[model samples]
Target: MVSPDVFYGALTRASGRWPLSAAARELVRSGVPVFPCVPGGKRPLTEHGFHDAATDPDQVEAWWGQHPGANIGVPTGAPSGFVAVDVDVHGPVDGFRGFSRASRAGLAEGWQFLVTTPSGGMHAYYPATPGQEQRSWQAARAGIDFRGDGGYILVPPSEVSTTGAVAGYRLQRFNAGASSVLDSDRLRDFLDPRPAPRPPENPGLQRQADMSRLAVWVAARGEGERNRGLFWAACRLAENGVPASDALDGLSAAASDAGLGEREITATVHSAYRAAHPTREDSASPTVRDSSPAAPDDWFARDPVSRPSSVRGLG
Candidate 1:
């Protein structure tokens, strides 16, 4: 597998009218899934298993003569589902320049919005067929686009709400290996304490997992009640007297007491912190639910906070 750093270098290679999305579109056209490296499922491509999909990372790597593993996203957009759209770049010379170049290029290509990811150095989005796979990729890009495909050249992570049936976007460096080669359970373990130096797209997505954590936290409660609990916790964290950290700690304690634990709280707190102060970069989350096999048992079960009775309870 290529090192993440090397993969990143590939992303930096994208320049001029060849916006990342265009790069990704080209990749998909050639048949390759973009896999962004992130611990856990914070992004779908990172989380998705390839064998089930009849694809393999080794095959992709072998085909590209690239490493067997690298983080990137796959093309979730249905080959047939793409729509025309426009794009706008929001600030600074660096971003605007890249975007403008891509924009002009996209226009030349008959695309309304093709170059975006680099404009923000983070998240980006593209309109395409919607699906969970797409959602995760967009989350990972932090600021890139490609309705779940094209990999890193265009997609980046972002919390920005995408309108339409399309899920989200993601980006890539070169090739992000195939999702089929990874062992689902092994992947979960690798993500349990996902290494840092994480891309802007990582941390924020973990918070999405917290929703599932919240659901599991309020295990004694129904789905609606758990949602209410999460909302209440967010409100508490936002209160004037509460430090965001304190609010999350307090809320996490409550969850722990309810039978959840530290790992859950840790992951959840990171999620909440990110929610309150998102970098334009953070996006994507593991696509699996809390209890799903796709999720690792490491933190949630072994975490000191994972135990409800040992932890503090929330209001």
Candidate 2:
């Protein structure tokens, strides 16, 4: 049901001639489903030749409408809202696994269903009440995939929005449709305040933060104090691509924000990098079954795709 090399075929379509990020490469290697994100409003060019942005409503409608054979299942409209959390783990962990697990439980308590991505990350879908879309995305814990009904569950690659478009994760546009989550009332009853378990100590958080500051100081050319942590995270993200610059101490305010010092940030990054080196392979989830092409969605009403409130795929 698939081409000779399903993932490579997908990657070839998504990445084109350009080099892929370590995270992107990881997805292709692992056979995870990946949707190449065209920068917002832009369309594909080279590798773009491989896939049609099935995401575009008109394109999807036209293609599916005519072919009547394509299996591109769109999500149903239901409760709509976004839940983004700025996790302050305060340090690093064996990986983000513990944090993701805890995050899902908290969302469940909030009466939301959960979806876990390949990057050991999770997205929680909550009741789309009145103020759902009004929430701020600053240090956002989640992102926008809103199509209104059933809305969008998978993350689309986006640079304008810093939501779920992380460097290492593959966003699966299920196309199989979504399954409905149970009543929010019962879920809420179970988790009145959505109490979340405390993440274990991440002694390396401060160091990672400092390193973040240094990277910001280097890239953004601002003072390092404000954007230090952001810089650190970005550079760490970059490590998956090309080698990073080491002379962070010499650079004056490139990556971090204004007012931060470099010595501390520089020292911290070095230490954290030493401790938390995630390999390209380390980011993989348990393999997806049935590498075969998915079944036709002709019997559309028969099933839909969604994160059932109680179910989560293993990472």
Candidate 3:
């Protein structure tokens, strides 16, 4: 068996070329699923997006032939047997600081490949655990995100338009012969670190009650109500000082029980969390509930600002 170190070394060296099309072909040869991205943009040319990623040389050649200047995009997650930790630079939190914190917490130490993005972000590549179906997440408060199942990332040598603030993406670190891949469990732990135990207090009990109420509210939601309900619940959770991971875990399960798909639940909850907690600090919790019965459409049409001050935080 080819050792992991040897495989990573070869993959890293193979990624050094400038021509994206050629690089795409090389990645395909190396067993990494790849597809053509729109020239100077992140959108994939394939109709099915990352689902169309393939290792077939003929298909890759055909894609590049049609769009010679297209950029290279690699699908992450199970398809490529890897996940990417994307540390972005634009948020209030510093990406490097968050990464350093994770490292200090004993995570990401085994990462073997790194890429610098066009927007001054970093992408750390790690091998995916077999049969694991991790999903993309925007850890906005921490300035980091995960690109896994159902997501794609543009690879090095792929340049965005110069009109943008960033120049382009480039390869940074590659252990030419490293024998290990980053542990997905460690990465997940870093991303969703367990909350430290808190002392028993009235506030903690109150928060639990609030969370249960929110979960019940989410569970009561039906078709066309998932997104709005999740957004509202997430906002409430943020107000109650619940951590994002905890809130996502509880609310996602409730959403699933309400017949919402994983994708919808993830997107809705993340968006709501970011909107609710624009800063790292917790917002005031909503105490009043609108008890008036109303049409589902009416409830959905109401602007977030029209809700209680605490709920309006999600706006």
Q: How does model 1 score by TM-score? A: 0.22
TM-score attained by model 2: 0.25
Over the stretch 42-155, how does candidate 1's per-residue lDDT look in tens digits? Answer: 243323332112134444444334322222344333432232121323343233343344445432122212223322343322334344223221111111122332222323
Residues 173-216, model 2: lDDT tens digits: 22123322223333322322211223324523533444444344
lDDT of 2 at 42: 22
In order of appearance, the predictions have TM-scores of 0.22, 0.25, 0.61
Can you tell me which runs of candidate 3 are displaced by over 4 Å?
1-17, 162-166, 176-208, 212-315
| Displacement of the residue 94 alpha carbon in candidate 3, Å | 2.0
Each prediction's RMSD over C-alphas, in Å, is 19.1, 22.0, 13.2
- C-alpha lDDT of all candidate models, in order: 0.34, 0.32, 0.66
Query: After TM-score superposition, what is the CA distance of residue 181 in candidate 2 from its true location, in Å?
Result: 13
Flag the better candidate by TM-score, 2 or 3. Answer: 3
Q: The CA-based lDDT of model 2 is what?
A: 0.32
Candidates ranked by TM-score: 3, 2, 1
Model 3 TM-score is 0.61
